[model samples]
Target: MTHTTKNDPVRAGLDRRGFLRRAGLLAGAGTVLPLLGAAAGPTASAAGTADGDPDQLFQAGEFAAAGRIYARQLHRDPGNAHAAGQLGYIDLLSNRFTRAEHLLGRAQRLAPDDMTVRRRLADCFVRQDLLARAAPLLPAAQAEQLASVDGTPYAVDGPQATRVPFLDVDPLPQVRGAVNGGAPATFVLDTGAMGLTLTTDAAQEAGLAPVSSTAVTINGRTVTTYLGVVRTLRLGEFELHNVPVSWTDGSIMAFPDGTVTAGTLGTALFYHFLTTIDYRGRALVLRRKTPAQQRAFRAEAARTALRPQPLWLAGDHLPCTPGMLGGYGPRVAVIDSGTLDCGLNTSAANAERAGIPVDWDHPIPVNGGTATVYPATAARMSIGAAVAHDVPGTVGPTPWEGLTGFDLLGNFTHDFFKPFAVTFDYTAMHLFVG
Candidate 1:
């Protein structure tokens, strides 16, 4: 849902009122690392015929409230394609891919022309890495182009340096940067994203040249995308060249909190450096690890008893780690920064294996409403050695395959802000919460 691309329009045209916002990333199957929230980030559908305060709740970011409203509506009209479709769309926004697939698929059967349901169902397939299934649902040219997307490897210029101020936007971190050496433009820092993302307006203002194309889902709408390279992207003192950038309709630029952004900074560029999100200070620090610093960190890890979680490569070239959910079993979770809630969102299998209890009592939020999200809890959940006892989470069947049989973990800031820092030491492949 979060990952996208852009260029010339592929379909006949897009009606803004019906379009969903641009978004985060394809959830890695093992850990299911898709960015789920009310932001214009990774979203689901907006097309069900049902209507009510659910629409307002979805817009208000009260996702749980919206889902409950729709679930109650479904009780009166079990065969309503609109209710089922809308519920499924919300599930997708909440990162419940399998649920989205089931609902959206049923919706499509009930209302074949519901473009929103079709697009969202395709998104469920894409999120599951079933590219073959998604390709057929999108424009042919866009599909062929996406099949060949190869971004350049990122390289940090110098030794160790950089500490830039940031603005906390709900669950996201906002920073300023120059595009093609242009004046400063605001960018949402999303770890779930892969490369640089610019709305067409921003890309044009920065003079980017398009070279590739693809169709991607944002919220519940599908749009054509062209891949281009930026000559130079200057973030504070850190200057990066040959950066892969996505250009799409200006939809991704709008944040849920009402802030308009020029683009997003994803993990593709961040992985090359050891980065830290200083929550209290609202700062972003990027530096190459020095041998001395690495040794010092190792010693500190031992002292703090910080378990070292190995960062492994996931789709879109992001690093992930094998962790335990409810301390029940091992699941590879992505270190995602673009999320709206706390704790892990798990598959039924993962939750069951860990012995987590599900009440089938919680409501899941979406783009325009909500769906069923069971409340579940874990006795203990750990990433490396960083553990949370009596962790709160949701469990049920999901559309995602999961990163090594896991979904996602924590609100990067809200849940983990108590630590001195939540650091990603890419060079050493370790995540430290201390």
Candidate 2:
């Protein structure tokens, strides 16, 4: 497909939203890496082995252990900028915004030229609702993202706990919502995406006006994107106000019946609520993250025989967990809600390590490129007590390997955990499956 361009400010073509639909970047294919994958982002550097080095452990997705080592290093050598930065990164992943801000700020002062540290600090400021302080350090597009939500960030306007029944969508979950009082439109619950994104038609129907504009490079191809604010978004019994949104002037993905999804509800909205994608119950539940609510959830989980596993949020909104694929232990597993069709996706290096074969001669088209994808079965895949045997998945080269020099062993899709009710407790940094 040829890339499309547009002249209208609010109708830019092939932005991140369009890129996602075309490249399947969030579907574990890794055709084009995340926004964090640009020139020498935080996780792009490597130091040593996980045996004693914090950098290696951090790259290995062993965040807890890496934090301990980095803390010790920082204590012994107070000027250790790398140690401070790594600790800050860990805290950011764990959602300790204030602590992360302090550590990252210190790291930036020590190593002013480290673009990675500066980027992480900017992100920390944004997370703390200090957009003005972060805007200068961000790129044009991301800076515009903050500006869109400058005065009025996302806020809930109704009851604390709201339940929205999922519309009948296969593989991925969808719900009916309206933007700025426009007609109701369908939105997918895409944890793989960072923020809310709408199609051109949806934005136009809502009468959205562009507030910011910039160009972003995807797979070495530049695409123009515009930012706007969604004054109100109605979902079920609740509503969200002043949400930042980006859209493409062109159409997104088309279904078999010639229908198209309106938009996507990503992590940006879910971060404000204790989100639960109740697959078994056929609903999306959102609750305030209060201590009382946490206690109630713990009691309920105990009664339901659901085990809590550690989950960390990495670059942007990527939710990562520790899991095993085949015989490999402690591999980084991403719980990608955007991925459908397959249960798990593993890198070609990991497949070879697990003794899975690949037919390189037969390449399949992906993200406007050819990839040698092969099907294989893992003897067992486990995340905490939740384990599946004889799991079928795919193997191919992934951009993640090039980004971190670490092979990502598992990318778990929504269908893989469809039988359980999954809850992401960001406040507690835990994922519970029942």
Candidate 3:
């Protein structure tokens, strides 16, 4: 779901009051009544009928109607944590932050252990500019059931062991006049970056000319930098020319590994091809999609949307409100290769708290540190049609909305899904391929 402020006329097409009334009728008639006195609970038909209508409406992009149905359900069962969490989510989609917060807060109070509620509540804080409050909830959310790392519950297996198909490319070759004298170096594949970036040493070795220089911050503080254009870059079966590149002045040649990779691949690479990163399989796949494939991808994107999970404080174990990733709407997990761990904002943590098991034994290194840091364990991790067991993940601070990466990617044949379309459904917390 995406949110648009009242000032943004582009999203003001729906009538909130009318939609809410109709939703109330449908939810009461279809769901709440049937579950009132059943031994086994509501029948599948009842639940399906009740849930299906709003789901269909949501899928059809009827945001107003969907919001109303969800709202109605919440009114009927003010204590139904799931309904309340979802209602808060609706408020987020409509840019009703205050209302969303209110409903989400109520849901959390009703179900203090619900992770989904916490995730949403965290999002409310972020939207309201409460960064400090939002930061603490990330760890708990990342520790939920789905976020995985390595092949274990917390560590991600590298590409070498996964055998996922991938197109291999060396940024060095595309670099003009590169010295090519050093030993072969590896580079991290980063999707979160806005453009291509290389280490100062690599850029100098490649002999690329500096067009300009600036200061930028990474991981934390500000640093001096250089910007330039590459004459040509070749990777696998594709080639690009005169691409813009950025280089840091620091000696940080690569992630801590320093051997497995030397540079980073950013969003610049994805604009030209459909790309997939399989962390479990330790591979990156890239290919051009056909026109038909492109249409399917776009259609799936439109049909799927991300639900915001609540962010939790680092140590506090409690449910928060519900929310969704804002601008991206419906797509398989938004990739943020820049992020070090698979983190959930507060809302996701709340969702996980509600349904998934919590295992803290699994520990994984974050920020390339071996000591004094570890993430949580995930009970299940799935991407598209593939699923993995005992995934590991952690929570951390974020500047943007939400993202899915390493924790889930490590389990799949990353190379096999390249050039294919992928969509993530935050409501279902599932990934689908088109």
Better of 2 and 3 by TM-score: 2
CA lDDT, candidate 1, residue 414: 31
lDDT of 2 by residue, 50-162 (tens): 44877767767777898898888788778888889889888988789988989999998888877778877886776556778887776555566566674657777887688
TM-score for candidate 1:
0.58
How do the predictions measure up, each by TM-score?
0.58, 0.86, 0.41
Q: How many backbone clashes does candidate 1 have?
A: 27
TM-score of model number 3: 0.41
Where's the lowest-lDDT run of ten residues in candidate 3? 27-36
| Candidate 3, 361-388: lDDT as tens digits | 6533322121222344444433333333
Q: What does the lDDT come to for candidate 2?
A: 0.67
lDDT (C-alpha) at residue 181 in model 2: 89
Which candidate number has the best lDDT?
A: 2
Query: What ranges in model 3 sit over 4 Å off?
Result: 1-185, 218-220, 255-257, 278-283, 289-333, 337-348, 351-374, 396-399, 402-434
| C-alpha lDDT of all candidate models, in order | 0.55, 0.67, 0.37
